[model samples]
Target: MNEHDFLLMFSCLPTSNKNEWLNLKTFVDIYNSKHDTNYILKSFPENDNRTSPEPEILLCDGDAKMVIERKVFAFPPSYIRDHQLWHEFHNTFLRQVADIFSDNLYELQIKDVDIPTNKKEIIALAKEIASTVIEYKQEIKNSEGIYSDDLIPWSFFQLSDLEREDSPIDCGVCVRLKISSHFYNNQQLNDSLPMIEAQLIKLLKASAPKFDNYSDCLRILILEPHTKVLNLSINFLSQVIQSIEIPSSIDQVWLATQFERDDEELIRDYYLVVSNL
Candidate 1:
């Protein structure tokens, strides 16, 4: 989702108890309002289901040149008040990962950048991705209690031409394997800030393949539980990119945050953060 439009939605509710937020129709209207009520989307229920369908929460234009998906996750006061939220909220994230890894080439392709040149390798990649999902599930389960004080505990799922087998594509990907806090509490978030600042240096050592043989490509890292990172998300991504062996190949990465608007209830925000760094 676009920042301006999403901010409009977030501004509407501000901060509520989670059960008292605007509906999706209101959100769509608010988002479309900035477009001068362009014919793109008039309203929901009518134009809502009819246009802009991307995988899950993603949105794509007519040409599918750009695909944008969001993870709408916010905690209602009631939901957070009950406690026992750790895995419950994280499992929802795992669900998103499962959905993404299951994507066919068409589902993950990035226009203008990704090419369909290598079908065989693409299939092999998909099969490995599927197995990786199974492996991570067990890993997530096995590593359940352990929390990282410095690292985000992310995973590496894919680094390819948006799942295309083409040899001449420009899409690569990486994964982060932790929830918002990385198993730390409020204090932990505070403590990790400094360490998180050094993420780029860490990623240089992090194991990942070079997508482009001659160089690298457009690398997109979809991170969840971005609610905690906020302004720091871009910095985190920038550092990671800079530390890469060849930073030029990576076009950009997106940080996904699911949050209860500062003021509204029931209306959560699915924010996809894209930065030039």
Candidate 2:
């Protein structure tokens, strides 16, 4: 909690500008004085690819760290935690996407242990997914309906998973998907391009200040965003990285989500980091 102690711990921020660094340091120093223990508050911008909730503040000391991301959602109507609702939403969107892409396999081999595995194959698959994402994004943008969450879910195949599956027919490797609301039925897509631009603008403004210090990283973990919006969010962050007033302050920008695996217990929830950036 001592100013001298904190100065010794973090030796870089002050190098940028005395006034600015002092402001940030003094803020934490005051926080430390309030509590009995000395503390190093990392707004946790998630150092070293660490995965957890976006912490408001983290108390880090040696190997012992306490995360303060606690919240009490007193019976909120809009806070969606019900897995069934999400599953239903995702399933509906998947079915719609399936109907659209049924005839447009684009040469992707549906046979077991098949499809592209090389870099070219990977690029081909990415392009296919990108195209689909754009279509769904457009559909959502053009809809006249309201949304608490307007993003649509997208499903696709992973070459590695598809190839490793012994029973490709029911392996479920080809259908990585999410769910969304039922507001996108036969919606006319008006001003799709404008919508994309506006969304990108929103993302950049929201993400810019997340990294305050030059060493801080910007890593956002989304709960249930539209599949297309996820792609767009990453792309938008990348596009604005260089344009920001002090871009170097942000070392990296990551968009990650929770995933399941064989060793899920060890990590509680593993995050799969992804970014168009």
Candidate 3:
């Protein structure tokens, strides 16, 4: 398999750095803690080319008894598409200027919504960014260590030196660009209800059949969010799941994501969607 495909599919394997691995691990940890069981990773049946409709992950207490089918859902699809295009631009830009910005930690915050889609435009924009970085490298390296510049196709761009004392983590890199959108609320989440329910039902339909072979096992469907904004509420999610039809073979469906507690600490948390118990 190719590197991308392997990384995407085998994320449930032990010690994998992929977010899916984190989702699965978090679910397992929560499950073990809640149930007081010693279930551990058993195997990845989906990787077996010989099998049909295989489970993404299988967990065991003593013998194989639980099956996990994972699906990543994104809302308003455009966000993920734009985010990907940004990464494409990032790669081209980094390749063009990696030598110039060597060994300095930086974060490029962009407020560009109209991101380029085509390869030609992406490459051209990357060049533009490379030039911009070059033009401000001296000022960027100054003691203050922050620069804001405007460019075509982007209204605002800010570069910050992450090596400062207030930096979140010490990324020992020349520069790093982080893309994120933290604008979302319960009202917006409610507005996307129909689309969310439709997409989730489609996923259940696809994954449910895979559990036919594992009827004796505790079947679980994990829906992980791929979009930047999926501020899911337990009450809202419970209502959505109640309106849908989960397959009989699947005993549970869980929405797993990073949860911020009342204490402002972020932890992996799961909310039950469909529970036969």
Candidate 4:
């Protein structure tokens, strides 16, 4: 489906209050009303004593089978200081959900909500949240294995400072951009975008592909504040592409471009701008 169509099927959950939940529900409902697919909410059973349900949102497919969870927040400082708490709450909730549903239940998905802030602390907070969600989801996979259809896949999304326009560049954003760049590209030089994309695809094949071509999958979206950092990441990606040798079947690289609009532009530029060895 198209981006709008995909978004409609994807759910948003904010673990804050009724207003936020209603806001997200309203958005999904509006979007789905235009599309043919179905969207529904799956509330945590009230009797089930969990972490107060955290007030998150879920988006399901036509069959009410596929699901996506959305988590929204304000800034990085809040997330950074309470990173551990977020993880505990999220993990506890997921495990409890798994327990409630058992192995026979349908798949569930998790996604972090996007916040518009450019503070370094806020950007860092978003990255931390993204990393935590990835880690937590990985742990679940390790414990449950891919065969267990009951497992819920998780992803993250955060709005970048670029979206805010009025925000300043934070040291945290620079650090995270640099680190993520190095982590993905440093190991594989000489790797084509298609190849690197392929490997990432393989990594998430059973669960959620880092980038979902289809809207059914929940994704982590990050918005970048500065083009310079985006350029740096592309350079880093170029290095990664050059360093590694990969097969041909891979078509695209799947990265969380939630906040890096400039990077998205550069990805398009890669077609014309050949790497200068």
lDDT of 3 at 8: 16
Global lDDT of each candidate: 0.32, 0.33, 0.64, 0.33
Error of 2 at 214 (Å): 6.4
How do all models score by TM-score? 0.25, 0.24, 0.73, 0.23
| Local accuracy of candidate 2 as per-residue lDDT tens digits, 55-92 | 34455655544332211111111222332233343344
Summing lDDT over every window of 10 consecutive residues in candidate 3, give the lowest-scoring window: 4-13
Candidate 4: deviation at residue 78, Å?
Answer: 24
List, residue by residue over 137-243, the lDDT tens digit for candidate 3.
77766644444454443321223543355555444223343434554576877678888898878888999888989987999988765554424444455578778
User: Which candidate number has the best lDDT?
Assistant: 3
Local error of candidate 4 at residue 141 (angstroms): 54
In candidate 2, the residue pairs with backbone N, CA or C atoms under 3 Å apart (3 or more residues apart, or in different chains) clash, namely 89-179, 89-180, 90-179, 214-249
> Which regions of candidate 4 fall more than 4 Å away from where they truly are?
1-38, 43-64, 69-190, 206-277
Model 1 TM-score (2 dp):
0.25
Candidate 4 CA-lDDT value: 0.33
Clashing pairs in 3: 104-174
User: What's the number of clashes in each of the models?
Assistant: 24, 4, 1, 28
Error of 3 at 72 (Å): 0.5
Whole-model lDDT for model 1 versus the true structure? 0.32
By summed lDDT, the worst window of 10 consecutive residues in model 2 runs over: 5-14
By TM-score: ranked, best first: 3, 1, 2, 4
- The candidate with the higher TM-score, 2 or 4, is 2
